[model samples]
Target: MSTSTAPDAKTVRQVRPALRAGRFSTVLRVPALVTIAVMVALLLVLFALDIAIGDFRIPIGRVLDVLGGGGTRAQRFVILDSRLPRALTAVVVGAALGLAGAITQSILHNPLASPDLLGITAGASVGAVAVIVGAGGGAATGTLALVGVPLAALAAGLATALAIYLMAWGKNTAGGSGVMAFRLVLVGIGVNAALMAVVSWLITRASLPDASMAQHWLTGSLNKADWSTLIPAAVGLGVTLLVAAASARTLAALRFGADTTRMLGVKIQTQQGILLATAVMASALATAAVGPLAFVGLAAPQIARRLLRTPGEPVIASALVGAIAVLGADLVSRTMFPIDLPVGVVTAAVGGPFLIYLLVRTNRKATL
Candidate 1:
């Protein structure tokens, strides 16, 4: 004869924590899933709208037809050859920057942390500008110019990231403690200022034509987007994002402070190194594709966090928000302005005010 028994106090205690963790995960996941679905829908709409509204202004229906491989010659040429590449480039670059920003912000536990603010983009700009100046205006042509600029940008950006990391490193903060977030940001800002000065000086020294070309690129235009650049960038970013997604649990743990993260069995320094490198690669690729885009990185993750009501940045949602933001900015630049303005200009106008709001909000929270 067997007797039924209730769980003991210790068993209950362990089971209760597990149950609560499961419930909390479910609660967090549902909201994030819903947010992602909505953003995907919004991105699709913006993408269709972008393809439909150009010099020729094809109807949305026709745009769909073209996409489905059933449209007239002119429609096909305009959509496939002219408009699609630029729109896709916007999506790719925006997503890359957004993911990079989200990772940087979350791992560092700083809302203001972004590739732009941390000097990654500035370093890329310096490299790209150097290429333009070295090659002269028209001399930098064909495969070398096309490939050389991005490679230089990636190299320079990685070097800059390395510099910031070393400068931010301290004896006390070394070992398992990792670099402090605040110190990293301060060093990054100083590096960013210095790099921008170098870029300005380089431009000033160049000839009129070279300077104009560099200046135009520095403004971050999609006019340079081609299948050659876009394909490689998209593939690289996709792989990096996969790595980031796999590290999602580590990122979540990191937010709870170093002791808690260590308790959770995450090697803090190793994870930070991997995440920071992933972020730098993403940012460098995007900057290489389109010159350093301004606040897509800074704004998208914050916007996603608010929209999802998540305590930390939602990587996928932030990426979609970034794609929408850039695509929308590109649309507005193309349609709203008498002259087609650089997409960067439109983003800066919007992001400048958003930055101010963030500063004000952070100040208010501190005061309280």
Candidate 2:
């Protein structure tokens, strides 16, 4: 591929000045902060609504008292035990998925690079299902399933990512970023399909009890949430997100082009390693917590980027936007009809069309 610009320069376009710094700078920080703050407030209001709109109504003051550990016993039991866990779970899982999507897309340089798009969720489901079918929900069994499932998913995903990345790099390591993006997404589709086939096979072999359990988990319900689940996710998310945020500037330069980034003093191998590790951990941890809800990462960052309209990755906006996406999808699932649909169904329904639109837009722009 010959690259030429301005009549004679060929073979490698210079990185644009705007994307060179690897940071958001003044242009991005202000609106990003405002968007993030609004998302938090909106989420809090939605959470309160989630608390209030349950089977019964509780006064806002009373809900606060209940949460603060000084309310009527029944009130305490209802709000403290029920809604709070689920709401907080939504926030954490949403953040994880959002961050996961951002880093995956940034690292691979593809808007469509989501865990669900790449089959990480399916891989996680397969692990979760094998546990359900083979191990019968004993304490040890649940523990092992919880531990084993996401690890398997992460391992499978990382393996798949590495394989695609390596194969793409072999053709021409120097200009492989765009090619890597294409290869990863295409191979991810195949990997995801293969993983789904395995999951189906497991479903076929499962005993009735196992089949039921696996089926429920796959539907992506938040009913299983608790502090036990929330704490681990929070810790995992906190660590991985910090790493990703710290790498924000590096990621910006990355989008400019790797060689440009390297010229600008970014350590290519190290940054890529950390980025992949962070993306994988954020994704694996979220998958462990909630069984993969389809489009938290993909939708959140895209939403944030559209709103922010700045150069480079919308890391912070993406996180806040992720929370909104998850909460919004869950709200729809909860109140869309008499029977609450699975959260995954809501996300899939919303994300699928949105994704098609993005693909078409990219295709048109490419042709233009």
TM-score of 2: 0.85
Best by lDDT: 1
TM-score of each: 0.90, 0.85
- Deviating ranges (above 4 Å) for candidate 1: 1-28, 137-139, 171-177
Candidate 2 residue runs with Cα over 4 Å from true position: 1-29, 137-142, 145-160, 173-179
Question: On residues 197-315, what C-alpha lDDT tens digit does candidate 2 reach at each position?
Answer: 99889988877777776777777777677666666567768987788767767888777666788798998667876787667666766766666787777888788788878654577
Among residues 3 or more apart in sequence or in different chains, the pairs in candidate 2 whose N, CA or C atoms overlap within 3 Å are: 22-249
What overall lDDT goes with each candidate model? 0.86, 0.72
**After best superposition, candidate 2 residue 82: deviation in angstroms?**
1.7
**Model 1 clashing residue pairs (backbone):** none
